[model samples]
Target chain A: MQGAITIEGVDKRYISRGRETVALDSVSLNIQPGELVSFVGPSGCGKSTLMNMIAGIVPMTNGRIIHNGKKVSGINRDVGYMTQADSVLPWRTVEKNVALPLEYRGVRTQERKQRVDEMLKLVELEGFNKSFPRELSGGMRKRVALAQMLAYSPNTLLLDEPFGALDAQLKMVMQQQLLNIWREQKKTIVLVTHDLSEAIAVSNRVVVLSGRPGRIKHIENIDIPHPRDVFKVRFLPEFERAYDSLWEQLSSEITKGESL
Target chain B: MQVDESAAVGTGLNTGGSSKAVLAYEAGLEQRKMMVRVSQVLFAIVFLSFWQWASGRIIDPFFVSSPLAVGGRLYEWTLNGQLWSHLSVTMLATAFGFFIGAGIGFALGLLFGKFAFLAEVMDPFITALYSIPKLALAPLFIIWFGIGIESKIAVSASIVFFVVFLNTFAGVRDVSQIYIHSTQIMGASNWAVLRTVVIPSATAWVITGLKVSVPYALVGTVIGEFMSSNRGIGYIIAQATGLFDTNSVFAGIVILMVVGAIINGLLKKTEGWLLRWKE
Candidate 1:
């Protein structure tokens, strides 16, 4: 009854300054409905490259990405893609920023205006609708970004380090907000991050990636309940075991990526 | 990254966020407070008083008119409506030149920005001519268009074109790659991407160019008028110089200065309205 994302043996490469570098190699995954999956590795791990493929920001080198049953070509409007930076335009008001997609899709003005109201209320940005991005705190801007992404009610949410810019405390708060939104909306969410603890905190399943031409080393399902408090659950034996297992499998690949 | 702002209602100050980013706010306030009203008034008073004292006691009136005499002549010319008609002529030439030049500059800038090949190929020629003194070509312009509005308009447009074109090109080229990637992921068509991302992002550059070109338009028109025209404030100054009518010369100079200030004010007002987001 719900949508799923299927990656079929995808490969990606980038040619920069006359050097051809393979980014992803024969990566395949099946993310089911209501799934919160995270990809974790060091820099240039191709976590971002894989996310770009699913989001269709970059063309696949040698594979197919299917959202639901149809093949994705360029960008998929039915999916929300959030990047590491630049999720908002500074010129747009906070409310206008949130309602950008709806505006672009040519939603009726009246209906869209009402949705803007609903969105601002949902993001707790009701009174700050007129405020610009520069006026808002870093945390507030991220919430606005999340609200904007949620406005279209996409079936899939692709996050590329949504909390990368925030401080540690702020990142925790954002993770909780994201968890709450997922609980209510039940969108199939895929997050890419370098932080191992963050990957385990909010995701239903954590996919560990080997650096450089990234491939999944391990996929560990948390089997934990929703709204899991990281502060309380993070210290448990199960969490420690899962973290070690991922580190053990990824340690060599991380070194390999760094040396190259 | 949701702020717990529900607890911060009516706080009146973002003390927490302000404390977190003091340098950004402090530098912003410093820029805003840079416009010194008192210094401006004092400088104006000192300059006029010095003009009056120097002309009345020591300096030759033929070279530098007294402030009082200049004021009186300005008052007389204004009452007879000579200044208004001349001001109107200058204004029309400036406005026409600015619009046409700015319009073309903006379009060409966008083209050059989007097409790197065109920019690379044409940039050398643009740079070579941009470095050349445009005023030297005034005689050619005068001979071609005659001593009329067209010559002034052509001069004004020529000077402003380089200023605006370069700015628009830089602005477009300066747009964040993040925005482009985000828009592409949003499924925006090429036209939509250009309209939403390219133009708005480059507007800051275009506005910067506009500020620089406002005075450029005036200088081009005034230079053209000085070279060949029989009307405008430039004509008044040129005529007054021959007769040693220092008061009239001073009056014309004062009129040009004030007119320049007023036009700058108008340009700033327009920029503020369009770029309220910066605030």
Candidate 2:
């Protein structure tokens, strides 16, 4: 019950320039505790919007989100959200950025340093502790971002295309690293991504959503065994079958979205 | 640029002076630095010599004021300690005005940035006030604040206010929504987010505004002094102009240039130290 998230009949409506825009409508989903679920959809699919609502960064217009049996309102401190863009503070060093959540929770300096050091080692950024974010490469910065998100040990993570900016090889490595961490911690994860293969490779369940006013179109269970080698997962027959089915559902929605 | 393999290898070595190549590279660099200094001195000498030679032949020495005459005036002012007193007075006015103006500007900028309705309501008035040539209001400031350092301070403060305010406002407004949302989701309260994220993010812009407004601050002080003042470099220049002492006028101008350059250099150093993380 620690990481269960129940999004019930959530709708998001935005009024911009006197025009009402329905971003998400009747989007209900139940995520089991410690489940790794990926939301795959086209652009403007309200995937990120749903993630924001679940994190309580944005409000749900019509319904509610419950996490761990408690209703989530403004600024859900129970979950950590890794944004698509680089959220690493340019002014802060890697250690400082990772230590931010701990500092917010009033963790003592000595304990904070220990945890930050451990997190840095986990992310393979141990030597770059004092280096500022601006001095880091894109992949290194992504690692720093991951370390920051995972530092305080949040029970749930909402990742929005976290590795979208990374190159193919680095993305695979990061995906593997993420899987390693998720397997160990068993934290509930909700990832919103445009890449269908990525969704299939990492998540236990891939939720495909339709275009604007986004609603769940299909949910596919990826029954691939644990300890997935993200680098070689595509070679597996089950992986191929899941990819084909998920691609079929996602591509049709994408085409429908395009025609509109 | 040629890739000097020996120099590159020399740079890679952690051992001190084990390689002859590093010594050669160091020597080359030293020579280049020396050459640059020599060129700079040579350029100054040529320019000053030309000015001295052309003073009487090409232009009227009385109007132009030869370099020697300007130097003589500078020495006389320095010997009498008038230069130090005037420079110190101007610096004090500039410093006080800059701090007060920048502080208020930064505070209001944050307030207006957070509240869109307030910014919108006062947008036109702020724009109108900023649009007026600040020097044009010097007479009015002189009247209101009297003919002392206070008038100069008022003038300099007005000049600095808009620059810092506009930059700080833009900096706050331009903070990415993603950063705010991410920080909020990470359990930072509104005040915490403002303190840790918003203010730090706007520091670069605020520093830039301060750097750009430095000359304007100086302008305000000098203009106020020119209009009416008892102790400032601008007062010296005004007095010299009234007496038609062109050499003293040039000398005052030289001191102003030196002061401006020194202030700019100090600002550059501060900016480097503050923004070293950027590198």
Candidate 3:
């Protein structure tokens, strides 16, 4: 109930050198608290723009977003945003990276350490506390980034292609871990990804957007039961049906995007 | 099961053979190192011998002093405590100028880096000051600081400031935007971002600037001493030139060389410690 998000007539435009480009059209959506929703679309569909708008990093040309009962203005610090790039600070050890947000919040040293250790364990990176980001493998570093975002226990999460760079096997493992965490934490999660199957596997509802000036084209409610295994969920008939419908909707947008 | 056991045995033997190959490679490396050392010693001995032989025979001893004579002069200076006094004076000037210049440069670099408008406004002025040959200011420095160690320090500091400031400024500007953005999203204040992200990120550049300016600091100090100072290795060299004592001049040059090498070694150690994460 605390992490519910409301978007109404949200529009985003970028103006450079007196030329204006529309990134997102008038879009509206309501995300209930503790719901897992995925935004799947072609490249340049402004999926990331929608994510940034919710996080309040990018200002909307018109319209507004509401997180919980509060209006989204400036940086929405109540939500943790994990960017697509490797966002872990290379200089800091894994433990230090996870503790960064806590430090910013002025958490006491004792509690910060305890929380960092707990978060690292949650991400299954218990023994890598002292290791630098450079020393960890790509997937391990991603875990550190995940732990860092979850360190402060923000009620909402905006993950922008968090596992896009990972190999297929590693990506599935991370998805499984994310699902487990989401189930346990019961936080509102908005995932923007290009992977169609990943959307059906992790999200309770899949929102497909049209290309360039992104607008919500279709929303499918995944009928799969809770605690679905990411590996096995794809084989389910319901999962396949959702994927087929979403892919059909998404592929047309990709072709339109290329032509434009 | 039999196939698996044989494959394991094969891997074990391969590991042993590879380790032996590694040992042989290490031995080869040691031998090469020894060869380099021997060759270096031989080159030094031969070069010194030729210089000593040529000083009186091929060229006048007045112009090119014999190595033995230079060595004797160094010994005499050391015995009379003149070497230590002059060496200390030069070292003090270099250290003072270096620290002052590096400190001011680092501070200004951070300040300008944080305030882009200030950096842009001051760009032309900084460039003008930097372009003026620092050594050419030695006479003015001597007049202002009055031929004391202060003048030498001023000369050294002025030269070192520019080198460090430019590097630090570039380092600050080159900081990754993603890092800053992520830190901000984590609720870091501007000061917190600078302290935790900007400063640490720019450390490699700062260290490089410091390392590069060490020689420049020494150059400024020696040039300052050459212009006006009554003491220092540069003074010894200037006085020897006036008296036509090429031996003392050569001795002074050798002392500066050794000092430079020692300072470089110390700087390398500091750089290693400061940037251990890089390794």
Candidate 4:
């Protein structure tokens, strides 16, 4: 029950220079505890906006989001949020960066060290504790970020294209790592991504959103069982069918968005 | 060929050629460094000799004092304790002004950087104030603080304030939004976020500002002394010029050059230690 989230009629609007723009309109969704859901849509879709709302970083213009039966007002600390950009503090070494959330929670030094070590091992970056972010390669930095996010063991994770910047080979490796973590931890995850195959490969359900003033267009149940090989999952018949159906829904929305 | 073979063997693998290449590259770098040092020493010798040779023949020695006369004057001052008294006074003024100015500027920068409304409201006024040539205010500072060390401190502090203030402001304002959001999501309080993310991130800019402002602080001090002072190096120069003692004037200028170089070296050391993470 700790990871369950209910978003009711969430709307986001931005008024700038006296021009009102609707970013998301009456978008509603329910994510059960331990559910892995992927949100996919065109470029302008409110996919990231919805994720931000769930994390309570961005305030909704109207409606509400409930996590664990409590209304999320601001900065929901129960969830970990990983943005597209690498958010590892450049000034901190890998160990210190991973220790940040634990430090914020007032965890003692010894426990923080233990947790940080565990996270580094989880992300396969066990030997990189003393290295600064600038010293690490792109994929390694991402691993550091992942380690940092997992350090505090948040019940839920809101990832907005966390692997978007990675090359294809690294992306698959990361996806495999993510799936393995998901299986072990069973934390509720809401991933916002543009990659259709990524959406279908890892999630229990893939939510397709329409462009601009986004609304849910179609929800596809990915019946492909887990312990999924992210590299080979696409070869499954069910995976193919789901990808084709979701692409059909998503492409039309993208074309309509471009015309506008 | 023998050295290369030995180096390759020492490296213990297929990287033998690369190890030899590295050794050659390092030797070349060392050779270059030695060449640069030798050239620098030769250049200084030639330039000083030319200046000494040409002082009486090409230009009047009175107008362009010879290096020997300046050195003699410095030796006399050092023996008589005049150098220590004047140098100490100037150093004290510079130190006090640098600390006070940098402290206030850093504080105000954090204040304005955190509050966008306050910064926006004060932007035009701050810009207008900053536009005024700071040296032009030395006379005003002298009048307010009198012709003592206080005025010199005031002048130097005023000059340093703007530089530190602007750099600190930009540093704080430019902290990455993602960093702030990441900490916030981790349940960091506003105070925690500022301490952890804002301050540490802005340290590079703040240190750069401090480094840049050191010379400005000294300039302000000397200018203040020039406008009105009885004791610092600037006063020595002013007094020597009034007496038409070109040797003493050049001596004071040489002392200042040495002082500036020493201070700059110290600052570089501090900067290296403070920003070691940049490597």
Best by TM-score: 4
Q: Which pairs clash (backbone N, Cα, C closer than 3 Å) in model 4?
A: none
Clashing pairs in 2: none
- Number of the candidate with higher DockQ, 2 or 3: 2
Error of 2 at B88 (Å): 0.9
Candidate 1: misplaced stretches above 4 Å?
A: A227-231, A235-237, A258-260, B1-42
Residues B105-136 of candidate 4 have per-residue lDDT tens digits of 99999999999999999999999999999999
Estimate the Cα RMSD of every predicted model relative to the unseen true structure: 4.3, 4.2, 4.3, 4.6
* Docking quality category of candidate 2 according to DockQ thresholds: acceptable
Model 1: CAPRI class: acceptable
Task: Write the residue-wise lDDT of candidate 1 on B1-279 in tens digits.
Answer: 234653443332354645636788898788767767667888999988887788857888778878888889999988999989898898899989898889899999999999999999998899998997777777888999999988998888888888999999999999997787776666567787788789988988999998999888988888899888989988888888878888898898888899889989988998887788885
Judge the docking of candidate 4 as incorrect, acceptable, medium or high. acceptable
Task: Write model 4 residue lDDT over A1-260, tens digit each, in one string.
Answer: 78999999999999989999999999899999999999999997989889888888899999999998899998888998989888999888889999999889899999999999899888877666887777666777888888888888898999999999888887988999999999999899999999999999999999999899899889999999878999899999999999899989999998999899
Name the lDDT value of residue B227 in candidate 3: 79
Candidate 1 true-interface contact recovery: 0.34
TM-score (0 to 1) of chain B for each candidate: 0.85, 0.88, 0.89, 0.89
Please give, for residues A1-260, the per-residue lDDT of candidate 3 as tens digits: 58999999999999888999898999999999999999998888899989988888789988889998899998888899999988888778889999999999999999999999999888877766887777666777888899999999999999999999988987998999999999999989999998888999999999999888889999999999999899999999999899888888988988998887
Query: By TM-score, how accurate is candidate 3?
Result: 0.92
Which ten-residue region of model 4 chain B has the weakest summed lDDT?
B4-13
Provide the TM-score for each candidate, comma-separated. Answer: 0.90, 0.91, 0.92, 0.93
- CA deviation > 4 Å runs, candidate 2: A16-20, B1-34
